[model samples]
Target: MGIFDFLKTKKVNDETFNSSQFQNEILAFALWKFNETNDYYKVEKELWGIQDFDLSEKQIKIIIEKLKVFNEKKN
Candidate 1:
């Protein structure tokens, strides 16, 4: 890892990635990732992206609960 790498950033388009949209997109992507392989480890990376995703408290609870259900079903 280089110090300069910390300076790098990815920009979201002005029209595409506002707060609510970012959350929705991350959730959507995580759901798709989960569906793709049914692997929690892989899905977790997407969930980390979702920490940057702006979400309401209610939304967080709902999403986490859904994830729990998914894992329970998988096990």
Candidate 2:
């Protein structure tokens, strides 16, 4: 491999980075909403509105699980 080959391979796609950042933003918003309302359904609904169905079921479930853990620790 050339000396610069590693540099090319190490570069991350902007789209992928933005997608992950967006997911983190969604998670942060969901957590904040849940903390404020203490209602999972409300937070889910808000996330749906913000994500506009972009997030998959698995992602949603993971967010819900995190929220549950956060709630437990909070109590």
Candidate 3:
């Protein structure tokens, strides 16, 4: 391996870290919205507006389902 290869690896790692961080931010916002409104459709629309990444329908449903379970346990 060359010395420059480490730079490429670091870039990939940074991108992965940023992506996960963004996901966490999205989930946090979604959870807060869900807790407040208990309306997944509104949360989905809000998330779609704020995100830079392409969030699929399945992913949105999964997040909403998880949030519902979480809210149920908290109550």
Candidate 4:
């Protein structure tokens, strides 16, 4: 088997991945990516994408607020 073939294999079923227990993994990714970018406009624009995402509006707001804080803390 090719090295990349392992990535094609399902590490976890969809149901488990959607569970709250697996949720922090998703949040951590967004936070990490958000911090990686330097522009505030880019961050705000990217934040809007979560409006149509599967997560609730409250969750989206929380992430945006958290990201805003990330910039604030750096100054």
For residue 25, model 4's alpha carbon misses the true position, in angstroms, by 5.3
Best by lDDT: 2
Please give the range of 10 consecutive residues that has the lowest summed lDDT in model 1: 51-60
Error of 1 at 46 (Å): 4.4
The sequence of per-residue lDDT tens digits that candidate 2 reaches over residues 1-75 is 888855542322346424867557767888899879989988877765653335545566767887787778978
Q: Give one digit per residue, the lDDT tens place, for model 4 in 7-72.
A: 553444457545776556554655666768865456555645543244444555555675667657
Candidate ranking under lDDT, highest first, comes to: 2, 3, 1, 4
Which runs of model 4 end up more than 4 angstroms from their true locations?
1-53
Residue pairs of candidate 4 with colliding backbone atoms? none
Better of 2 and 3 by lDDT: 2
* TM-scores of the models, in the order given: 0.41, 0.58, 0.58, 0.38
Report how far residue 59 has shifted in candidate 4, in Å: 0.5
Report the backbone clash tally of model 4. 0
What candidate 3 gets wrong by more than 4 Å, as runs, is 1-24
lDDT of 4 at 53: 40
| lDDT score at residue 57, model 1, on the 0-100 scale | 43
lDDT of 4: 0.56
RMSD of every prediction: 7.6, 10.2, 8.2, 8.5
